[model samples]
Target: MKKIFIVFVGLCLLIQSRAIADEGMWLPSLIHKLNIGEMQKMGLELSADEIYSINNSSLKDAIVALDRGSCTGELISSEGLILTNHHCGFDEIQTHSSVDHDYLQDGFWAKTKEEELPNPGKTVSFLVRVENVTDQIVADLTDEMPFAERNASIQRKSFEIQKEATEDTHYDARVQSLLEGNRYYLFVYETFRDVRLVGAPPKSIGKFGGDTDNWMWPRHTGDFSLFRVYCGPDGKPASYSEDNIPFQPRHHLPISLKGYDKDDFAMVMGYPGSTNRYKSSFGIDYTMNETNEARINARAKKLEIMKRYMGSSQKARIQYASKHARSSNYYKYSIGQNKGLSALQVIEKKKNIEQEFATWANASEERKAKYGKALELIESAYENTQDESAYEYLVETMVRGPEIFYFSYGAKGLYEALKQDNQERVKTNAEQLKTELDDFFKDYNANTDAKVAAALMEVFNNNVTPPYQPRFFNEIKYKYKGDFDAYVQKMFDKTLFAHRAELEEFLNNPKLKTLEKDRAFQSALDIFDLMSVLGSKMRETKADLLTGRRLFVAGMMEMYNDKKFYPDANSTMRLTYGTVGDYIPRDGVHYSYFTTLKGYIEKEIPGDDEFDVPGKLKELYEAKDYGQYADADGTLHTCFTTNNDITGGNSGSPVINGNGELIGVAFDGNWEAMSGDIAFEPELQKCINVDIRFVLWTIDKFAGATNLIDEMTIVK
Candidate 1:
């Protein structure tokens, strides 16, 4: 009876706190229908006026919006200090980490601004607000308009609205239309054209168990990184300026000096990538069944291949971390998602929905008009381009593309075309970039080239491309009588012009490089050249297939405006609202809203790379003096869970409350939702975030950067 009462009371508190979190802003249908001031019921204790005042005043100017060269971020300080998740900044930061100074392994910290790392081509964009123009947008699109024309019309309308909304505003902004032709939202933004790194934990600490712990339960990793935003001489936005000044945001979050307890009212505001809880069953099935299995299987194989080269070469390690990071990410996320699909019964649910939709529509003419032809439409699409489309991704991503694909959607052809397009747009940049290419090639990977080639050869032989009778293959055959390993080796490095040294050394080695110098590598380079052509074909087909399917769904979905879709999770700015609470992930298996400092200690296998705690964190826990925010567990926990909706692109979102106070920084979600690309399991899935309190604790206790903490109002 007593336990029941406690749970009942706890439920009430959770409801109240969730209400209090959104003190003023209107709640989207996703979070608990919360209004701005509703969070007080959840133990916020503060009145709506107080919360609104805080949102409108406190830190309003303190939190400067940050763009991680792409996504949005908030400046958490007055001195150009920035805060974002470790994953968001990993790419640029990784470029600077190496064997001698492996920051990813240990994490990066700058004692002062001068020591902060500089990353070229990175940016931070600040958002102002978003407005809806749905009715106006829909009225203009005629049924007669061609798909191309309709899209143009929508773009013009959206662009105009964006221009007007951001007119004369110092910040940058854009308008994105969601659900094809159904709705539109204009986002006003403040862009800091040049952003630089401030600090970051080592990869061990930032990424912790690397990909092993990503999006899992009972996770104990700190996936956070730090950076600073910069602008031009006149305190304006500019691109890559040495003469830039540290940008000071209008409002910065006052690091909560008074920590949080279990039911604190909170919310997160940042661009969330995407959530497909509302997708069709066919979409769900393809992902949960075929796509998931195929992708995970391929990734597992690719990892084995990558390990071979990465272990053998340091240069290979450096060049491929980005690719490794991407594949590892997919591998981890996919497996987790596969687990989620089963656990959440995503496949069954998809089948059920498909059946239900059909049964519901069989009797009604209106219903039939609405979606009765799903099977016919779907089958036609599959027949029209399945093989060609599959080949597109294969050609673009796996074959004729860099095995070490970076920023190439598994398609090197498309990447090159885009690269060319960008280069053409900047002729001067093309000239300057020519100078950078030599250095890029000098640092290019022999091992990576081999690995990618091997992967490509595997794809070509196994799939679309035929087994060719190239000399590279013959070299392997001659060397090892057709042993696959020997074959792989020859294909990887069997240069026709075997000139390891200069041309003079290989005198009659009429092998290609015999008479030529470094030109011996030309055979491989020549094939690399054809990448653009292959990429172009792949791009067109991929667009025709992926886009066609997506657009059809979007077109079908144009009628369902009750829910709003943000976009394809393009790593942009977004906001997710939820309260602080925990739930039972499975039967009788409860997950606390918060974990503790002691939890970290218990998990630490002292010196075990996966569980090693930083000295500062160890000291704090050893002291056992958690300030106001420590949970009943007696440990200061950095991570927490919530019921807020999210997906891959939401990796670094900031979780906030009704008053818009950031309670946590978003990173990953529970694996059960990995099918989230198509299904949503509200009961079992939760978003994992780095608590705001942890961010504060790191700044004050560990990093010893107290200057940032003192800048915020430490509310109790």
Candidate 2:
């Protein structure tokens, strides 16, 4: 009863001191107790139970976590049609593209369901429910327990609980810690394995401003794609099969054609990937100096090499499109994040907060004993940035930069089987490698990867110290006379993994001697070995860092008992509500809430890769052929901005209106708010969404994909 009273007081305090309406990403299950009345006051027409319910169909059933939270998608039809950002489905689109049929350059639409393309290993998970499991997880833990031991205990208890919840069911379950381990919640999901591509616009429309205008406002990108989910006869999750039928979902969002006005109510719900709003000043410094710096330096060189190769031929462009996009996206993000952090003075603000908290802690002996040393521990852990810097560089330059090294590492299983002289195991592993070869080599260019390897190797050598460098560097220095290009050329020429035919021949008749002499395989082993060593060296510091963070968060919750607090995002299902509004990004510079098709036409460059306007799209724009998809103003609005909080995994989240109708599809965040993951700037942070009407316009008028549009539930 005493504990219950404390919990109730906490709730009351949170409600009394709620921050700006746009500042939180809230869990759906707790909305009834914590936020429903506030949300209703802000113009929400639906009840909490209508948004999330365990016994009845609700909006939760219509949301999906594509590939388990890499991105979000929404169900638009009862036949399981999915609407997500084109970038979210880029891998599949690129995989099916070739010189003869370049879907990325030209749009693709399935005239019939039979023509819809299948993608292996892709999944879409629907959230079943969420339950607070704090007591079950931390009831037995004590303050005296070591951090490692406490974590192990939590993991064991969580596993037991998850097993019990998911036993005899096809649903998958996870127990995620929240508020820096001060809270815990269980999330169960029903995952479907067979998701297929239904339609996509050409790059000229879908990726319209490309990297140049990625995080900028007044966006004109038609960043949306269509997909469908399939299930077995029992309507359960199943592998891809010819006889599978389109899934029948319990609920789907009704698209709203009526356009929104400024300050109209808006909300977004999706799986936000991660954030560090409660991070210490020391942590922010480390991110700017070490992590972001390394990524920027390494990816700049790698992207340059890829761009040169991609411009060589049509096949080359199709092959490297997805890889280049993935690398360049974060490369630009890191640059923008550094600029925002400095402009916002985030580190200084964090220091002021820490000083205030320290003063509060020292006022009482009891508080001092419980919360003291939190900042000291955090500072000490981050004091030595060398090891962490080296590790970050190694990861960016070696592990992620070069494809050949990691691809060659896939044969480790076959190597182990051969060493054991297990013929059956060897046969199994060999066949597995053979199966993966087609996919890997289909997109891989040996010359391109070899160039990438040389550039990235030079980056690692220049940035990382001698002691932290991978052992393969010794071979480069002595055997290859310190020329990265020479070393990479020799390795590519000699390795069987570089080409499909050579690797297939070796797999057909495997031998231990041939594998042992392979230069690429040996280098892969050394690279991973160094990674393990670096990881082990950081374990103690990592443990201390986590302990300090957890205690600090707990102390802050008690210190500011009247303040509302939200947990950091960790790829969990969350809902954030706000309004469709514009803002002053800088003094004397006002930005509008939305952009129009006229801006897209004005930005077009003839024959340019990023801004090239499709001839058919130009014809329609010249004719003003927007049809019924245009707004009341008789113009097509391309994108709009909202104040709702979101992050990386919210890429394709639905933007819903007060009446619970889909208004837009979220795709990016404004440039001025790149530091939002650490500290939200309500005045500058904006959720950039592609207008739903523009999505419909591109489908019906631009592509004439009426069959695809016919299945949707549109509200005009």
Candidate 3:
């Protein structure tokens, strides 16, 4: 009751305050109680129930969580025409692509429903309901309870509640903590598995400007892909089958060709992955120096090696396209975030806020009792875990960096199965491993991986101390004579995992001794053994850090009742609204809210993969075939900017107008605000979206996929 009262009062205060432009990733279920009045004042034409309703068809019906929340997508037609970002579907596209067909380079368009490509394991989910369960969860907790005990009780209660709620349904339920465990909510979702690819533009359009313009504004990338949801004839979730039919959605979004103007109301609803808006200054410092820095450095090396191979071979280019993009996207983002953290003086700002909070806490004995030790605990935890930087490097370089080493880690399951001496289970596991390896090797290049292994191994040796070095390094020093390159070459030569034929032969003649002697497998075992030792040593400090953060967050909320607060994103569906506006990132640098086809043409560099404009697109531009998708000024809008709060998983989220009509697809955030995941910069943060009109133009005119265009409800 106390926790509920605090949240309720917070909501009342939030409703009375003037709203900031790009501040929150709000829960949709609480909109009427927390945001509707302000939203209506900002030009919203729909009621709260119209946006989110469990018992009726509403805007929430159109939205789907792609692949259980790696990204977001929307139903654009009654027959389940799903629209999501190209990168979100990059894996599926790559899996289906071949050297001869090259769907990635040439694109694919299913003229008929029968031609749509089936994607196994791919799924899209819709939120069925969000229920407040704070009172129920806290009913068993007391203020004097120990942290571990309280956490255990909460988890036990949440499991019981979720199990009971989802007892007989196909729906999935998760109990997520809000306000850092002070509040709680249960989100229920209905997931569909039989999703199929319908259409995609070539990389020349879909990934225009490629890595060079990934998180940049004034962009022209047509980063959209088409998929469809299929279900059983009875209209329930079903496995992939030829017998499955396209799902008839309860509601689908009407795309508005009525383009938005600057300052026009905009709202985005999607699963935002994460944000640490309440992070302490010490935590921010740790992220800047240790986590992000290690990631950026490690990924940079891998990207360079991948780019070298990709640049040389057309096959390698297609194979590693998605891999390179994924690595580079965050590599650049980390660099930008470090710069933003420094340039924005975020640490100083955080310190000032901490000082203010401390002053207030010390002013009252009760406040001091609650919050006096929060910041101290956070600082102590950070200090105790200062040595984690080396571990982070090991994780980034040894575990996540080298392709061969990572692949070898999978052998642990096989090793365990072999020990069981169950011949039937062994064969079953071998076949399963073969299937996984087939998928892995489909886009794998051994030459590139060998280079990556050598480089990253050397980096690990140089950065980490002698005591911390994995046991395998001693082999390189003693047996290989300190030659990592030679060792890697021999491993690739002897390891059956490197080649399918060799692996198939080994699987047929199963032997535990062979795996034990294998250099690649041995290295994986050494790393795993060493990591386990180090992980145990670090566990206590990590537990302290988590507890400190939870307490610190609670303290802030309790002490600062005047300021409105929103919880950090945790890969749950949220709604954020603002306006279609631009910002001056710095002095003397004002950017427009929208970009047009002309800017795209001017930026094109022929024969260059990153900025190459397809000959057909160039011809279209020359002929001014803007069609009905163009603005009144006769310019085709490519992408636009909005000061809407969003993050990584918000990719492919529908950027809707006040009328609940899809106007654009949110794809990227401005580079200037890369630090937004840690701290929201209301003035600088902007959500970059691909104009829905451009998506339509590419489908109807450029791709000649009028059948797709005919299915959607297009509002002029």
Candidate 4:
């Protein structure tokens, strides 16, 4: 049975591999020559060798590299140029842009090589390929090993593999687990340390419709950016150097000129964060739908308050910039998930999954016994944490949240992170504060005092000892005559407005040595110190909460379900593939992959600030310069749709053909896929890709990046 299971998984992997290999749609080639012939027969312009040749692994590098959260660029040029999304590179560009060079407001341009702007410390990564280590991992995680012990064993193995593979090479690799505890793979990646900002379109052109139009179809946003990766003299990763050369690639995608028609197969090759296809009806139905609403609402309130302050005060804007982005991300996902749940008819799906479980579990005495333990474990965790865990969770959240506004994983695995952990995360007390709060002031933002104070106070009151005392209580008392509110208010009214200089002043002040001595602050800092090593403690606590419940919910699903179930998300890489298709959201509403320029103009109202499309794009629309691009909207005659499995990290993934030519970048998934976290609806699930033609026209006519566009096979 196990052999059959392994073979089944392998066959599925082979099918997918062949779907991409040499661009054959369905048939498997018997030889390399046959494969090449089949690829060309299927309009697969690029060969398997060509595809593999361009898959260089030297993109992830920089002096201070951004974490996985940021959409990274891939070098398409040997002359040191890269391509990424506009939003991903916005901050660095904004930092260098000014009133005279207002890249943020009007966008930027560099007609010649000398015109490109150098970003002091930006990097890009290229993934070479992946290999399996399931045998080694499964052997190490034998039945006698506990989950923690199993995880540790895997980690040790991963380090060994990474060191071996990356030695004598300026590259990095890591081990990854798949199918919960079923499979494992190792990915090898090469990074380019020196990357520079090239050009961006103005907000008017780039972010035209802004947040309101986000996630909506038939959109007209020029969402693209240009960058270049540079390598040092010895042909290796290095810090920014004037003499650095543009990286040469083993393979580079030639841009496709004739855009895709409907029903064309497309695949996204990149990292995807998580998917909850294996979640129980219990969590997806009861917990996620109900609990996520409250969590989302709480964050919505925080965002509203922060936005109000940000709109009025520049100091507040800069200080809480990270906070707003973090909160907004939650807001976006929450709202999208809610929409997906509604679209999926979650309440109904919940009933269906439950009915199936009750029938299967009660089928026989043997069935009931089989599911009992798994069910019990999940119920226990829910009972313990449903109400009481939020406080501690919030404290833990506070310690990690702000630090990861722009960073993914909140910068886990830092040098001092593990040294500060408590032996056990059993009791929520001074130990948590000491380990988690140790780094609080080290990276604290002084501006946006109201929000920071409010967040801390909430965490303190809900999770800390005896509840209800501000951080740095003693310091505020000594510094401002015993009024925490007054001290916060003083910080808000006086200190925050002059944010940058004032923060330095507060940290450096001799009299306010109180910064380090503050009791509440110290407590929070201690917890920060221990956050890394406490993963096991937290995971154990978590296991106790959900999947551990064998007798309650998880058991029945595990024992009797038709498909094998994996646990809920733990930030792992997963691959979900399906057909290229569209979905009907309601009785009438539909979406498409290609949204025409004419359709965007049709939706526009004259004299409206937001509705205005640049005159040039409008002219191109009037002339119907689509080349071969088609309108996706059947009813509105505007846009098109596709089905490519994607999520957060897939935002900037390049959508490619069997020939390995760039089609369009995968940006957003449709509403159906939003339910993807809890339920992988193969029927309705689809991904939204911005067609390559829209990108081509924007570059050639709009941004006049004609030279860059000319590098590709623009068939026209």
Candidate 5:
């Protein structure tokens, strides 16, 4: 039977490559050919060219990729500051918050460098190299072509290898696709764009347990933040100037304050973003019945109409505090990833690894014509969950639940330049929608999006299926007869895209019958023509589910050719490593890896708004004051835990150690591995960091800010 299923997949790949040493995320330019000799026998005192070098300055230039990969920052000094996580600069501290500079309820310190703030479309990037171009993108493909002609010949040889690796560099490049497209790399980067901010703390100390301790654990939140970057006078990137400067980094992360013990080691490097550890089980039963049940039923009625307009004040809580923490961080991460994929059965362990790859592809006929219909073409392209459950309930109720149907679908490019009459392309798309109506009416509130468009149009007309509704739910069931709050209060009282001076006086006289008699631009053109007919019927079963997931990840990499695989997270820049232990998550329940400031004053509740507590962090925890950033058991620790393998763009990632320094920032994961981005529960995953001495004891003793503590290089 194909040599007894290749010696039962080489004894299940030698017991999953020796029970994963804190599983992989790797690729720091293949850590000197696959993890510097098992990270130098698990201690790794640097060297993989000092952690990735394209000819110098290493630790991948102090890891960045914030807005680009959506979170992860480090560069701890040589002036470009950085440090990341306070919910990844929670929308630039809720865009420099207001009720007279609230900085998300009191917090913000710049102390100089002209009291920092500027963050116009923030960016950070870095990376600068990584090659692999998988044999020049599968050298003119085959296996009889077509999967949209081998994805347009791997997107025209990845746009000619990212235009010859960024011709005449201002560097950006791309490529990506690893292991599902069976490898390819490139990367490049640089970015910058004046990022600013500088410091933050008071969402009760960077969001202390709000959303009742997000992704739980012994976490005490001080979830970091701070920023810097700048640049200009020939250093490079520019934009928000005033004659910029600070950008002097090629490697920064120093700050250790000598700490870390339980199995020490550790490591991280950032930009994690996505992970689908080889998906399947019909894509985790269509990601738990259609995209985490339509983002936990349209973000639980748009977070109860944005917590009733952010409790009707503090300027609607700084205009929906970063849109209610980005829709309650994935509506409680799809209710804890559908209770950790039904408590980790993980769709019966991906249906017993697709029934041991369909019994070793029907025991040969040349592996049954090269992997027989890869799990019957991924179970006939996920056996119809009716157009992927009405395209994930029209992308969680009208393309990411109300904000007036994608801001009146950005006036369909000024209604296709006023139906091609094109007066200079309708004055350049009406001066880019009047310069995006001053950052969309500065965090819009049209009555809290008209009660989130009448509670997500009654959760998409009682859960989709009227042939995927959206003819504005048959004009709200025949002209408001079904009311939906009087058809969303007469589509927000006759939408000139919900008044910002009547959409800048109808974009200074725009017409086409007043945008075809607007009602939020004809319900944003019937919600983008039913999202272009359900994205042309899911790109007709997405080219046979991308040729059965690139021939089932190339027949499980030629049936585990001596194991060693990695590649899933796609935001990119990887490196994982592990240690600072702690995890028992079950039976006798032992949890602690770290957390103190006396468990953030034993999770205080004085006047609770998710466990409040900040009378100057309860007067520096009743004066023990933790000066040299404590922790020799003297206390003040805050957060920690590791066994590394992170996700969600390794939120503010840093947690270094083995003499690489920095030691903690990674923000949240535990809750018994919220399906660790599709399975990698090495004993209930972990990551959850914060404690770099509770981020320098909240910038030197709760915001004394001591000129941002003498521009930090602090290793002591």
Candidate 6:
């Protein structure tokens, strides 16, 4: 019976490995080759050409890349009204917020086009076309050529291809590799810089379930925001201007107030950030033991300090909301990922796969010559990098964790100009530095940073070996007698950058000697130098590992000719299809696919930070005025789950139904499948999304933004 059970599990694994109709993150341009028939069979109402067509308007025309590629947004109206996740627009909301007009606490809505708030640096890009350019890029390269020479040849050819693709056009072009550099495609994009915030729900509604409920199932977060794209009078991309008009998009999604049913076909199209689906067991073990451990520990300390300070004052809360959210989101994700990876036994599965691959490789001399040493290379790489734990900890704490380092590092160019004795260069750098410092100091809290620095520095000093310690750390240990708190206090009190006024004045009257004498600047330089050395060491040691993994992936593709192989995500737009579904996470625990407003109200704890229900929303719920957003049973759905594959940058991707109508906005993933990026768990993985009707209800009833609602093409 035990042997039978084992065999059954192996069979299940084999079945799962063959990309199911809904399992792969497929290239949209290759849908015909990989997924069109299956998608049509699964109930796709639109043809492949209707989904993606370079010569004509299609669903692809409506989707836009938010802030380059961090998130995605879909056009809801021809007037360029875009719908995306609230957290995707969190930074912009925070930028427009302040103590007096706290847009983050209270929502903002533009009653008219003139009232829309312009975002300076925010931009969105539309995919113009994708062309197969593999032959062009690697035509001259051979397998026997030196790896470095071959890489250089590919890069040089890619540069020429991108240049030709974008020549005499306003489009931006990039060459993306697929199948571990076995294929390449040139993608052209039209970018618009004039994006404006049209509307957003208050934090009480938009971020209702805060960190406590992030990435959890049965979610009730609204998780949606509204923006509009603007362009010049001729409908061409342009910089932000008062004279700019609302962009008339080629196509816009028709949102369906009709919610989905179980096993109903759903599709997601967006730029997913990354995945390591082909990672070896050695890499998995390293991530489990060192990478995740370092991130979890360092972020936990920083988040604790930020929360303490944020809890004390509303101003602090406003200033740190974006920062805190960014830190805590991944802190919790890292924790969940470690748990999921262990619970799913991913490393053990990887080892089994590796063993199978080894056996396959040894069956023939040609296979042995190509793939025999791959696993050894991977194992040697991880084993030789045991010190990466300490290195990563230092990076998290001293380099990235502390804002002081960032501020000082931002002025390195200015320091170099001063050293060069070039007055013109110094003057130019001074203005740039001043502008940068103004932006930095706006959201920065000195007291909070000082506390964080002291805590994180102590953690670094206590854990890192002497040789791995940064110079500033050693000074704290030997000179200050391990009194990190004292060192931090003194540094914060004396650093010119700590006082914006003093920093501005110093920028105005720049001096090389005075700058060099600045302790904070000196500390930043030393830490950056050490980080450079450590990064170089890591790159050098991991070179063979990278090559080996690439070869291994290609070898697997060759060996499994019957199975479809999709490349891991690299922040390129792709499509994933699945269904609205439920799952049993564990025995006797069948989770539902949807959550309603009633569950939301039940989860509310009045006066609690994470689960506070807005008074207006509560009143609307109490009065049973869900408008057109409620079902026949009078319950308004807040969120739902689908099996569509997603990752970090896929946030705000439109969850379209069979008829190519928007039903929800994809936001989070289930905690049970946090390991999906490393190894997809078919039964457990689910994409959590805010129902479109809930989003519309929030805009129409709770916020009374009828003008904004009037702009959308609601398919009721």
lDDT of each: 0.55, 0.90, 0.86, 0.52, 0.83, 0.86
What TM value does model 4 have?
Answer: 0.73
TM-score of each: 0.76, 0.97, 0.96, 0.73, 0.35, 0.97
Clashes of each: 65, 0, 0, 61, 2, 0
Off by over 4 Å in 3: 1-19
Candidate 1, superposed: residue stretches over 4 Å from native: 1-72, 135-137, 155-173, 261-264, 308-322, 355-375, 383-385, 392-444, 463-572, 606-608, 615-620, 625-634
Q: What value does the lDDT take at residue 186 in candidate 1?
A: 66
Better of 1 and 4 by TM-score: 1
- Candidate 1, after superposition: displacement of residue 699 in Å? 3.2
Looking at model 6, the pairs that clash are: none
Say which prediction, candidate 4 or candidate 6, comes out ahead on TM-score: 6
- Give lDDT tens digits, candidate 1, residues 1-716: 56434322221111223222321112132222334334444444434333222235432233333443233355666666777788778777777876777676666777776777787667666544446677766678764565566667778887777777777767566666554334566656566667777777765567766666777766666777788887787777888766778876666665553445555656555555554543454555556555555566556666777666766755566555656777777777767777876766655554554454456556678757655665444434444333443444354334434432221121223224344555443344324434444334433555555555556445443433323223344454566664544454553344322222322232222232221222224334434444554455444434234333444445334433343333434334433445566777667787787765666667766665456777767777778656665644555777888766566655666666545556677777776566555554445557788877776676666767665566555666
Task: Give residue 284's error in model 2 in angstroms.
Answer: 0.7
- 1-716: candidate 5 lDDT, tens digit per residue: 66544333321221134456767788898879767877778888888998888889888899999889988898888989888888889888887888998888888988897989888888898988888988989988988877888898899999998998889978889897887788889898989899889889888878988887898898788888889999897889888879989899888988888788898889898989898878787888889878888889889889888987888888887888888888898889878888988876778756767777778778889987988887788789888868778878888887888888787888888788888888788878888889878787888888888888788878888887677887777877887777798888887898888788877887888887888888878887887888888889889988888788878878877876766788888898898887998889889889879878877888888877667888887888898888888988798888889888889988998988877888788887877778878777777788888888888888888888888779888977
689 Cα displacement, candidate 4 (Å): 2.1
Root-mean-square deviation (CA) per prediction: 7.6, 3.7, 3.5, 8.5, 23.6, 2.1
Q: Candidate 6 on 134-157: residue-level lDDT in tens?
A: 989878987677667888898999
Clash count in backbone of candidate 4: 61
Off by over 4 Å in 6: 1-19
lDDT of 4 at 116: 72
